[model samples]
Target: MRIYAVINQKGGVGKTTIDVNLGYGLAKSGKRVLLIDLDPQGHSTTVLGDQGAELTVKELFESGSKLGIKELAQPARVHGEVVENLDIVPSNIKLAVSAENLAARIHREKVLANALEKVKGDYDICLIDCPPTLGVLAVNGIFAADRFLIPVTYARYALDGVADLFGIISTVRETDEFNYTIIRNGYDSRTKTTNDFIEGQLEPFAANVAKTRIRKTETINQAAINAEPVFTFDAKGNGTADFEALTKEVVGLDA
Candidate 1:
């Protein structure tokens, strides 16, 4: 299975939105998708229609926990209906404390990678929803992923701290074998100047930028509020179209 971590050091950049939507889109297209909610806030978990899961991703970070991904993962639901071929390893706020405790463990960063080894063949892709920080939990997500999916906003400060994130990835991998893609989220075509500015800023990473831009739309937020993906929330919405294009682009990428 190919693992992709949706991460960005800066918050409010649509990391969880992209992760959940992309995973569901892929699953609907006949791919087995496993989403690991690695964030302490558990936004992905809640968006997937899960609440208070007994075994969560939090247990994976705890030392000496025998729980495997199979045990932790459950069918993703939307409005009380199961989403076929999609599963999620839920998370909770307690994960923040677990992340702190993980710092003292030996081979802490590799813990997630090791856990995923046993179930590599179970799913076609594993999507990790990482927290908006360069902490131990994010490190574990980075170490476990084969590819990185970074979502950047249209704001001037969108690329802030991205260099630090790249530095950490380089420090961990120390090689160029891995691949990463930067996707512009919450794009507004009306603001030509801001769009041009953000586009100019992204010139350095042009090769890694995705052609599909997730447009700023209220349907996305509405779907999240209803605990459903755009596919189910509004099949013909702009959010659905953008995410569909993104799913195709991501699947075409070599991991």
Candidate 2:
């Protein structure tokens, strides 16, 4: 299975939004998708309509915890209905403590990669929603992923800290096979000045940027509030179309 870690050290850049939506989008396209919520805040878990799950990603990093992905993953639900072909390893606030505890362990960064090896055959794709920090947990996610999906906002400082993230990835993996794609989320084309400024900032990484610009839309927020993906909330909306295009891009259908 191909693993993609949806990460960005800078918060509020639509990492969780893209991860959840992209997972559901791929699932809708007949791919078995596994989403791992690595954030202590559990936004991806809540967004997937799972709250207070009995088993979470926390067990994967805990010392002596034998729980694997199969035991922790459950069929993702939306408004109390199961979403077919989509599963989630939920997370909770307690994960913050687990992250702290993981720091002292040997080969902590490889824990997730080792656990994921057991279930590689079960999923077509695995999406890891990493937290907004460059800590042990994020390192584990990065180490486990085959590729990285970075979501950048329209803000002027959106590219800040991205270089550091890439530096860490280079140090940990040390291979050209590991690559990344940057998607611009909540893009507003009407604001030419802001768009131009952000584009200028992204000039160095322009080749890595995705062609699909997720437009700024209220439908996304509404869908999130309802604890469902855009496909189920408003399939005909631009939000759904944008994510569908993104899914194709990720799967190489748009290439």
Candidate 3:
């Protein structure tokens, strides 16, 4: 399976949104997708409306491979029916404590990698929703993922923590293994400042930026508020189209 971590050190960059939608999009295309919510905030779990999962990522981390990933994963549903080929390993506030404990353990960075190795063959793709900081949890995600996806907002300040994230990834794996993509999120085509920032500041990373930008839209939030993916909520909306395009681009890239 191809595993990709949707990460950015800055919050509110739409990392969780991208993860849920991408997983949904890929699953819609008949690909088995597993989304792992590594963030203790559990925003992904909230967005996907997956509740009452007895075994969360927190428990999986503590138990390691003893509790198989398949057992820990719960189907992600939309409109009261399980979405085909989509599953989630939910996370909750307890994950923060697990992450702290992992920091002091031996082979800490490889903990997540070891856990995922046992069940990697079950899914076509695995997307990890990372925390908004470069901590032990994020480090675990980086090591487990084969590729990284950084979502940057239109604001220039959003680029502030890119270097720190890249530095952390470089230290964990080889330069070649640092393969990643930058997705421009919350984009506003009407703003001149956004255009300038993309052309001047973000131009250097042009090759890595996604061809399909995630535009600012109320439809995105509405779908999340409804606890359904954009495709299930509004099939013809831009939100659905954007993520579908992103999933195609990601799946096209070889792991």
Candidate 4:
């Protein structure tokens, strides 16, 4: 499978939002997609409308080879008989504590990679929404992924934190874990700060960045609050068009 983890060390950068919508966008284009929510916040699960998320990442982590990832996947909240190609492994708040507890164990950084190995090629694309921390679990997320994406919001961020995100990525490379792409998100070019960040700082980083940006839009906010991907909610909106572009970029990657 071509695994891509939608990751960033910062929260509220639209990581989960992008993951769900992009998964839907890709599925709409006929790619078999598997999206895993590694964020303990479970925003992906919640936004996807998974009220009764049967098995979580925690269950899968604790399951090891016992449960098997094929059986571990459940249809996303937005996924039904209609979107049979899209799958989700949900998450919950308990994962935060599970992560802390798992840290005390061996192979904590290898757990996710090992789990994913069980279902290596079951999907054409595996996208993971990683939590906003560089914990063992997050490292495991990177280790398991083949390629990844970093989402950054257009606003005042502690430059140190952005640097820290790259630091972690460098560490992943030092270990030869995975190569990744950084996606610039929530870019409101109207704002002075956003524009400055996009032009002055981020533009130079384009080689590591995505070709598209999810511009600031109310459609995205409304879609999240309604617990549905923008594709299922408003496929004709600008948000859907942008994500459709992202889907095309992803699909074109190894072609």
> For model 3, how does the per-residue alpha-carbon lDDT over 102-169 read when each residue is reduced to its tens digit?
78878888877887898878988999999999998998999998889999888868898898889889
The alpha-carbon deviation from the true structure for residue 51 of candidate 3, after best TM-score superposition, in angstroms, is 3.7
The residue-by-residue lDDT of candidate 1 on 80-180, one tens digit each, is: 78999999999999999999999999889999899899899999999999999999999998999999999999998999998899989987777655689
lDDT of 3 at 120: 78
Ordered list by lDDT, greatest first: 1, 2, 3, 4
Query: Which consecutive 10 residues in model 1 have the weakest lDDT in total?
Result: 170-179
At residue 81, candidate 3 shows an lDDT of 87
Clashing pairs in 3: none
Q: Give the range where candidate 3 is weakest over 10 consecutive residues by summed lDDT.
A: 59-68
> What would the TM-scores of all predictions be?
0.97, 0.96, 0.95, 0.90
CA lDDT scores, all candidates in order = 0.91, 0.90, 0.85, 0.77
For candidate 3, the clash count comes to 0
Maximum-lDDT candidate: 1
The local lDDT score (0 to 100) that residue 168 gets in candidate 3 is 88
Once superposed on the true structure, which residue ranges of model 1 sit more than 4 Å away at CA?
none
Residue-wise lDDT of candidate 4 within 137-232, one digit each (tens)? 688887777787877777667233766766786686576344667676776767876577655676656676778878788998898887888887
Order by TM-score, highest first: 1, 2, 3, 4
What does the lDDT come to for candidate 3? 0.85
